[model samples]
Target: MESNPAGQGPALSGNVMFYKKPEPLSPEAHGSLGVKRIDQPLGFLRSAHAVPVTVSEFGMAAASFPVIFVGNDKTPVAVMGIREGQNLFVGADGNSDQDFYLPAFVRRYPFVFASDNQSDRLLLCVDREGPMVTDQPEVPFFENGQPTKFTNDAIEFCKEFERQRRATMEFVKLVDSYGLFEQKSVNFTPRDQNGQEGPQQKIADYWAVSEEKLNQLPADKFQELRDNGAIGAIYAHILSLLNWQRVIQRALRTPPPGQPLS
Candidate 1:
């Protein structure tokens, strides 16, 4: 078996490499919000596009609120909107007299929606996927634009979705901080060992062991292990999970409460 200078092996069979062509990075990529670029800021409101019928169906009525549409290099990733005044609230029947504050993150993408009407400003962050959603609880949703009541389980799912989104963002920041993808050279030789294969083989063995260990732990435990200086032992395992994508999708979905799809 041949080995690269870094002691890494050649492409293995059944290995699928998904490479995202580096986008033309902007200074915002390294901005305060983490690995995201805000090409535009809050300004003149654009003409309203087709509003999802689900908004009214869910009995979410708000006039002239700010909606932020988050996306990646592709299509719209998530939509978050916030409204103010005494009439905006999240009630069982989607009718109330309380001001509503809604912050959401798409589970499958690195996006977040933070809105406060008192401040009259909506803050949008990108590439900051985190565990905004998880297995703890469920959030309600409007079905077919009808104010049908949903179980707490539904609401919990929505919450978990956001939790997962934030978690993904944090994970990306962690990897970037390590500069793991930055190109570097490493040396490995079979002859270097006592008549054994080179560093590549050693790395492969280590990865195999690490993977097994990671698979056995639950999500929370796995994260704890990583926080406790077991990162290298579980890097490959966590990366394989692609947990970021899950959070992104969830964030993109229309959230419960009387908030519009911003």
Candidate 2:
């Protein structure tokens, strides 16, 4: 696709995770750049313990991992692991377990949409430093000075991701308006071979939708939520909290260094 040469267009600021050098896609700057297929395409996820998930992904993500709301924006994130710099779901070979649902956010690695503050346009940018990106052969980003089929596909995927992101924001606002969010924590207690419990250790602290508050909402308000088709995702989030133990179990299977495995 046609684009402003590297030095032009609005600069992408802010600290985006995983993207070290995200530059706007343009034939002039990246005509020779393309991605090479790698054995471990998902290796980047190895360091990501929590990944953002949109409302539409809640049901699918809930089935695989705990979905928790976090921060002032109440961004929904799937808990992939209990510790920092570790993802239990992602294997050393950069492959996730079979039959587990992977979030779209994780699947859209190396490509992201950044808004141009000068105008109401979103730019499709790629992580120039990404491992899969290269100056050599494979899938070409541009052909005959225009974006190729691969680039077009990435643009479409990024576009859909942006739509889902906005929808997720609205869902969060709706949940907040009803005062259904509550502070919560995940704790783990170690047990000896004899099954003797040790001190409870707090693994993480975050926010969650309160099932009691949701149940106590006025009939009209509850019906409104149902009509909006948000009730299922809300219930999914609550139910997904039960999977925190599953994450803990996974963590126990792959304990951190210096710790004995149970």
Candidate 3:
């Protein structure tokens, strides 16, 4: 989540990461606005080191980047870099450095669902500040005051995302109830030109699913998790931790400010 840029309509609940100006979509407010392809559409991601991920993305994302749980909510996030405001995977051109799984959260950018507490319904909103959104146009949001196919498709994608988000919340609650989380730290030991190890630097501290605790659970409880289809996601999280070394290697290649390199 970042600072709320001045806008109209109901404010989005929870953390609205990467969104600067989110306004409710409407023919009156944004009929002229449309999305257009650009060279660096995802360039905004360069400053984001971690992005939220749904449970469904665990296995796919695990193979690409380290997925870790964070905050009191135990929100799942894919770690992209060891340092703040540094995304190792996103190059200066805003494209991924290599082929990898892109989180749905990132893909659903610009369009998001905001809860309307009063109406007890979800409202589709667009980030008026999104790079792709423009008035000059390519794919118009609306035609003849009705939402165009592009807008309708975006709505469907956002709806599915919301479903996954709710499921992720339930998964977090289940894991928390079982007391399966533990505090973990990421540390990196840099090397000098001679290949000698330097002092280890602490990179981040976050909550993670504890394999020990998980294994120690009663057989019945373990089976319950399995029956509930949570076992796969849990193991996926554990396996993803192994990729921390991969992230460290990337950091070394393009070391962050203040970090020494070999």
TM-score top scorer: 2
Candidate 3, residues 79-144, lDDT tens digits: the string is 998889888898778797668888999999899888765556788888889999999888999899
Clashing pairs in 3: none
Task: Give all candidates' CA lDDT scores.
Answer: 0.27, 0.88, 0.87
Which residue runs does candidate 3 get wrong by more than 4 Å? Answer: 1-8, 11-15, 192-197, 257-262
Candidate 2, residues 71-136: lDDT per residue as tens digits? 988899999998788889988888998778899897787888876777767788889989999999
Off by over 4 Å in 1: 1-151, 182-225, 228-262
- Strongest candidate by lDDT: 2
User: Which ranges of candidate 2 are over 4 A from the true structure?
Assistant: 191-197, 257-262
Give each model a TM-score: 0.22, 0.94, 0.91
Q: Is candidate 1 or candidate 3 better by lDDT?
A: 3
Residue 21 miss distance in model 2 (angstroms): 0.8
Per-residue lDDT over 11-55 for candidate 1, one digit per residue giving the tens place of the 0 to 100 score: 221211111121111222311112222222211111111121111
